[model samples]
Target: MFNNLGNLADMMRNAGKIRETVEKATESLGQLQVEGTAGGGVVTAKANGRLELLAVRIDPKLLADGDAELLEDLVTAAVNQALTKAREAAAQSLSSLAGGFPIPGLSTLLGPGGGGGA
Candidate 1:
C-alpha cells in the first residue's frame, strides 16, 4: 500500500512534465510533412502530420487530356493517401510521447482510425 501511494505521488509529480511533452509533440505535428501519389505519380498530394492537406499536384499531361473524371479520381486517391500518411505520422509522434505508458482512451482522443484528423 505504501509503495502504491509512492507510485501515485510520483505520477502526480511527473504529470506536468508529461503534459509539456505531449504539447510539444502535438506542436511538432504541424512541421511533419508527408506525400502520397496515385496513377503512377500523375497525382501527388502533400499533408502535414496534423492531417491538413498542404498541396496537390497533377501531371500537366493529365490536365491536357481533359479527363475531368479521371483527374478527379486521381486527386481523391492521392488526397486520401496523404491523409493516411499524416495520420500514421501523428500516431508515431504521440506514441513516442507516451513513452510506453498505456494511457487509457489515448487512442480515442486521437480520433477515428487511431490518429487525429484535421
Candidate 2:
C-alpha cells in the first residue's frame, strides 16, 4: 500500500521523461531500415522500423521472364519478410526504451504474426 503509492508517485514524476523518450524512439524508427529478399535474392523488399514499406527491387531477369504469377508470389514473399523484420526491429526499439521492464502484451502486440505489419 504505502510502497505502491510511492512507486506510483515516482512513475508520475517520470512520466514526461518517458513520453520524451518514446517520441525520440518513434522518430528514429523512420530512419531505421531493414531488408528482406526472396527467390534467391531475385526479389528484395525494404521497410523501416515504423513498418512502412520503403522500396522493392526485382531482378531484371525476373521481369524479363514474364511470369506474372511467379513475380507476384515472389513480391508477396519479399514484402511479408520485410514487414516481419520491421516488426521485430520496432519491437526491439520499444523493448529497449522500456529498459527491460516488461510491458504487458508488448511482445504479442509487436512480435512477428502478432497484429501490426505491412
Q: Write the per-residue lDDT of candidate 2 for residues 3-105, one digit (tens) a residue.
A: 5677567767998887778678778889999999999999999999878899999999999999999999999999999988888788777777766544445
Candidate 1 local lDDT, 14-43, one digit each (tens):
998877887788788899999999999999
Local error of candidate 1 at 4, Å? Answer: 9.3
The CA-based lDDT of model 1 is what? 0.81
CA lDDT of each prediction against the hidden true structure:
0.81, 0.81
> Candidate 2, 44: how far from true, in Å?
0.4
- Candidate 2 stretches with Cα past 4 Å from truth are 1-8, 102-118
lDDT, residue 21, candidate 2? 80
Model 2, TM vs. native: 0.80
The worst-scoring run of ten residues by lDDT in candidate 2 lies at 109-118
